[model samples]
Target chain A: MATGNISHGRILSIQSHVAYGYVGGKAAVFPLQCLGYDVDVINTVNFSNHSGYGRFGGSRASAQELSQIFDIMDQNGLLYPERLLTGYVPGAEATEAVTALAQRLRHRSPKLIYLLDPVLGDSGRLYVSPDVVPIYKNALHLATIITPNWFEVEVLTDTKITDAVSLRQATQVLHQTYHVPHVVISSIPLKSWLLDLLPAHLHPASASASTSEHLACIASSRQGSSSTVYATCFPCLPGYFSGVGDLFSALVLAHFTDEPTTEGETSLSRAVSQAVSKTHAMLVLTHEAAAALPEDERTVTDEELDVREPIRKIRRMRGRELRLIQGQDIIRGTQPIEFRRLQAWDTFWDA
Target chain B: MATGNISHGRILSIQSHVAYGYVGGKAAVFPLQCLGYDVDVINTVNFSNHSGYGRFGGSRASAQELSQIFDIMDQNGLLYPERLLTGYVPGAEATEAVTALAQRLRHRSPKLIYLLDPVLGDSGRLYVSPDVVPIYKNALHLATIITPNWFEVEVLTDTKITDAVSLRQATQVLHQTYHVPHVVISSIPLKSWLLDLLPAHLHPASASASTSEHLACIASSRQGSSSTVYATCFPCLPGYFSGVGDLFSALVLAHFTDEPTTEGETSLSRAVSQAVSKTHAMLVLTHEAAAALPEDERTVTDEELDVREPIRKIRRMRGRELRLIQGQDIIRGTQPIEFRRLQAWDTFWDA
Candidate 1:
């Protein structure tokens, strides 16, 4: 791997953009730019805000528009980005368009590191059209890395990830059957029973694992026949936060390189650990900021908001948006918080 | 003025966004984020790249689309941005939409600082339709600050600015007749004849004025009957750089505050000096990066590119795009370079 490419990278990121809040490209673009990458974005949906509020205004980019943008990019030699990131395309046609775009980008730059965040749905609900599922599945083989949350893991692999064992099995299916070189399950809700499913060495201490306060991130890297898995557990912040997954995937691209620096560490695991650490710190900052908002302006947790009243829902959602701008110091690595729990989970993925 | 507002400003910026290079919002957004401002953007034009390349792809957002976005923002209570920045709206209808949006924003947040960049054209060319001129002229009174280059100054105030004296006169018209609170003539071409028109104290040294190596930036702030103008002169690099105005206006918003810090210094003047200094440094860094590219990859000066062949034009344009990502240190103010010479030109505006 070339050191120059890792330090000074160029990425063409296709994602949704909200005019008033941070989500999708809004969440992803700035951190990458701060980390010293030229990120060129094609906005998949131009909304006033994310739909987590139950209502948003703005239209999605059509398949034809995507093709037109790509055509000009190709004509102008703007397709030579070192990385390509795709997230949150709204429709089936647009999904297919993005898949075709990924294929074209890979064809142009054979060494292109394509990080596909298969943004189908999360938390057992499908936010995108059902047709987007097969499209994302078919495009999986083209990805250098795929960052999927627990719900997406179940949706993509046709398996239920109720515990650690099932989650590991689904990730292995992505590595072996789909031929994805790397897989990062972005988050898993670690219930007490689910914690028991992990191997003894990988388990959290009894005092730390008391409630459902901890969530885990698992990463796997496959090089030829050998594959390695690593997991890190961190305490989850209360309340709803949009764009954590987008930010995590973006950080993975920024920190990812196949060159391992020290013993007992793979580059994929190290990158995942760094991304997870930064994301956790940023979320803590965001949570604190949201909590500090005046009582009248504060948002209720996701469980508390009434879904029927869109106006009330949108108002509450505003206070819950991620404070990416405020967390610039952490995103740029000036304030590094190392959440160290990256341990080998190779036992779960026996050859 | 509230310190909390200054440290955590929220801005609604309506500008162009391109998928490939740094221009318009692409040039402005990241730096503001690095400076700790939450910037929400409405992309006026979505293009493959800036039009400097002669031919590019993508469509401009329509007047209806802008209205739709604003309607949703208003409905969702996302309308209370602390700052509103507008640049490069394509047609008359869209310009009106932006003007209406500005009016609504000001009505909601009376303390809102509106920075309007009348992006009419450069040099002597009119890239936008002539119809956009009257709409911009009528909307000048709504801006707290208007940053326009020499050509836009002429087009907006209907006065030809051949030298510093005429430039000052045109800016006064914007301050007096149009009722704009502040004006920043982003650039002035410093020809030897133009140098002769300046008051003695504002003139550069004869040795330094031997050639037209320098350009001038003049800023004026009006408070009732009293208005002060300040001038700073810096050497101009020999290349066509895009988005200097957008970046300048964005920085001015980030730095500007009405409260005077010390004797003989207005907050407006201090902000202008910092913005001009940072812009100059970033341009120097960008020019050096362009020069260091491989010989075949290097672009010729704007005058050297043949307009008849667009393929050659775009190929050359590739190397000339701003290196905003690489210059993140300077943009984020981690590497500060203070370029002094913000002399008070109050003599030009004596009662």
Candidate 2:
């Protein structure tokens, strides 16, 4: 029974809800429930909105408080996880505890998938602590697949990356150094995309020419064996919003879990590309929803027509109707508009 | 001899840092510093990165740990603050104790300014624990200004707002019910450049595009001061970063001190707006500096460009040289391309 059996075990994700009050975890939980994953999220911190935009409700719980959560999980036998997809683990102590948990999982099951969205720095900068870099270093080996932006890739591997050549070079170094099998570098700002030296697509043009559609997708290459570079760009019509990574991580995990027959199907390149495509589509559709409204009133709600009350509106989408959830992309600004939700897995191939 | 000389005092704040390590007291202290006030911050939470993103670090500090901070402040004679600006006070026990502190501030300084963000939920959403909201409500009556997004405003005021009429209607009830002089209803998707919607202007795309440029300025009117709404928008830009309220509250205390001469100049509307403008400009100029870089490697570091490193990597145009400290904006998302260490008093103007 142990010989190459596709195991259907539990995945416990320890991440923060990158939402203000209603959308992040509150809204996130709905799609999670729809995806058929027994998800128990340890909200490291909950604010009124994502920290990127900078205002939110207060915070509760300390990093030490998370240890208590693990204790509770142990008391209820909930810690028997087959996979631990850690998202935003708050601080040094929590990282230590999580590293210990990774060691524990290695001992407990030996094959638990640890997909880490190394939520640290972005856009050629590290936003957290210098102390955190080392903690994440410990995690690099523990993680089966590590998701980092171009900036973090450089920090982790200490390689100056600029293009596909350098990105793969850094990814290779990262994989070898960290001992993680797969590394996906996201948001690598291309030279072409920089709107007048935008530098990593952080540029805003003097005026909006229908809002340029920029994308940062996932890519990878098989070491010394494959004939291709694993890369895909998932572009979106840009307007700032938070929690894209949280949603992406959830989608990747769901997709991995969805394919019951194969634990490793295709390279990380394909999986992330597909995931990015889906995410980009969802974002586009969200924009269309916003565009349909008065410019000032454009925002998406999981519920229908919240036009009557718009003050407590969400900046991001909270996609309800999981069964309706399809692999079809949400309407992008430029893409075909009829974005239907996932009715079946076939949508992925068809799309 | 004691002819009501404006009471000299200090306030303290404590919170987390995003990219850097342990921005503890700075979250609270820096804001007060902007207002030309002295402060001491007791960091209850210390992490490598903020919890908004997927931070991988530890959090250490307990009630006992917090008490040690208070002990230090007590020993140093910094506890006799005339006002207190509290943001992101984590834990139920801390909430309980803070209520007591709010009460103590009033008792110790008869005219103490207690400005609470009451960060339960913005945009009609709740992010904290079910218990935390109630705890916030308990402390609301003691607040001089309770700044919440529209979502939180509704929950506190129990109003069904659809238009300006309802918003005004809701504002009256909030002031009457909460007894807080000013209620900064944030993220109120409206089309007014008036002074009252300072909080909304702080949010993104919540107002008209034409009116959104002049940030940090207030479109404000006091409670029951309907005729006070002005057509001209105030410009106090650099107030776009996270935890600016924490800073604003600190400034308000100093500006609104019980002095006769400074009283006229230190109007709440004027100081907050001025601080807002300075913060906005700091962040904006930083972005412009970042934009000024060469294409492709526009996201260059000071070390990369062979220029003297701005302390916070953000540059503020201080006379002939660009100064970079830890600059932030009162409004989120509208972060300056760089940071500066300039103060609100250094940049803001009278209404």
Candidate 3:
């Protein structure tokens, strides 16, 4: 199971690609490369920009196209990667293709660390085709780790997460039922009532001031009958960001792979803490960069205002793109900001 | 015309992408991003591995598809990149599309820096569609800078460069006749006779040991009637390397854009010197990595021996892939190897 250096190992990242802005592979690939990974990217959909823009152009790579790429790599002895990262597959057939590919990769290298970011949708909606839900659900067992936002957790587990208890219940389903070795719920926006349900130590420092403003991320590792969970919380920045989740998943893969042999709470905590801290730093930079843009570039158009659109009103979504290029130093670990540390929250989940 | 920082500027990079290996955009994009440019990539071809692998999988992005991407970017106001880089377009139609895109970009940003790498062929053979030659020729006037290998210069200017004088004559055709302000003949294999034809200072030190063992790159910049030229020479390493030319072109774009205002010999000299030096360092690392592979991985197959195949004889192409992931520090300029320096060779070109 030990590869001498994880950086020397290759990562097969199947994700969407956009020419204009960061999302999917465009967001994830550079950061992984910055952290020293030879990333082999399979672009599921190549577009002009992420769909957050009111308009976008380009086509999705069909399931057949995905198989064609896989066949060629197989022929050339290039199909095996030490790590597999799948994000943002747009349809059922594509999602199935990704799952099959993951199975093949895992079969070839039993030690493969498959980090599946189940990008079904966000904000209580399923942006992906409904048919893909079962496909992702079936694929969970193949993953070494899964990074799902709370909405995705609810969708996959078929549970309503209203409080700490229900949230842990859903996580338990993923761990005990599905047999996912580790699960990292990427983000959780806390409400006052939900914050109060948790023990006081589990609360984000900012939750005392305004609970709704705090975002917390939970990481759990399952070992036999019991599971270990940890949480990190930070004040949420107000802005639209396209690839923060993709970046977070990529960084987690990097850190987790760096400590590949260690698979329990400590490894998960360190990986989640570093990823959360780095993502927060990038988001803060993105928000500030948007604020620094010229008034004209940062203004909402009358059409957007008329529709009362959230995306367009946030400065045409132009000012809101992730500032990955400017934050290269941070990604390279040269100028890292250790903004937040993960705190053990096993008690909250147990209670 | 004044962009606050070149790094903050967006670069529209059109190239090929291989899923399993580094070549085209896979090779160029990460290095450029490491250098801190927000590179928006339009992949002209997406393949499983580079063509050097003898077998490949995937499809070329069509000219119409390229146009569709451009239209969407245009509609979204994402087309006005401060820098435009064109490389390794596989067809006449795609090359024409790239030229049109470059024209549109320059039309929008009159001060845009367009670095065009006419990736037609290498080693006296045309790897791309032969019909693409004229399109690249027609597209030359739109380029702010062009990086062409010696073979490409012969094809473009319709001149045989047997000696330094003929080489300069061909460079003059690109500069004065074609209105290309900056021309970099990326690599020159100096024969003993050709080396003698040049002034002594222009010769690489390794030239004295074995003239054929050294490689040199020439950079030239034109202003009105006169053009200034600089040359850097280094010992050639033994290896079958893919994407070395692509990497060279990308580094030139990064350094030249970093010094955009002064677009003459000094800037061109610094750009080419840094590019050549950095490329040399990466190549040295690549060669060492290939040599360090397991003996079985580095052995030539009997079938290849029967055919006397140059590619297979060099070891499995696996050993030869660019170590870009491990060389991230070098790409980031954090661990630079200033292996060579550019020398003013105006006299050699003048003679």
True contacts kept of each: 0.63, 0.00, 0.69
Kindly indicate the candidate among 2 and 3 with the higher DockQ. Answer: 3
> Which sequence of candidate numbers ranks them by lDDT, best first?
3, 1, 2
| lDDT (tens digit, per residue) of candidate 2 on B273-337 | 44444444544554554455555423333454434433222221111111123242232213433
Q: DockQ (Cα-based) per candidate?
A: 0.54, 0.01, 0.54
Q: Is candidate 1 or candidate 3 better by TM-score?
A: 1
List where candidate 1 sits over 4 angstroms from the true fold.
A1-7, A163-165, A205-208, A223-226, A299-309, B1-7, B163-165, B199-201, B205-211, B223-226, B301-309
Evaluate residue A150 in candidate 2 and report its C-alpha lDDT on the 0 to 100 scale.
Answer: 72
Q: i-RMS, every candidate?
A: 3.8, 22.1, 4.4
- Write the residue-wise lDDT of candidate 1 on B1-351 in tens digits: 111212467889999999988889998888788787889899998898998877688878899998999998888888888888898898899999999999887777678899999999998999799999999988988898899988998998899987556766787789888999998888887777656655667676556454478887888889686578888777788778888888888888888866657766678888888788888888888778778877766656555556655666676678777778777667666665666556787666542
Where in model 3 is the C-alpha error above 4 Å? A1-8, A258-265, A300-315, B1-8, B257-265, B300-315, B349-351
TM-score-best of 2 and 3: 3
TM-score, one value per model? 0.94, 0.42, 0.94
After aligning candidate 3 to the native by TM-score, how far in Å is the CA of B266 from where it should be? 1.1
Error of 3 at A111 (Å): 0.9
Worst 10 residues of 3 chain B by lDDT: B1-10
lDDT tens digits by residue: candidate 2, A153-260:
888877786544565567667656667776666566534522332232233222343223544444443345222334433344545445556566655555554343
**Colliding pairs, model 3:** none
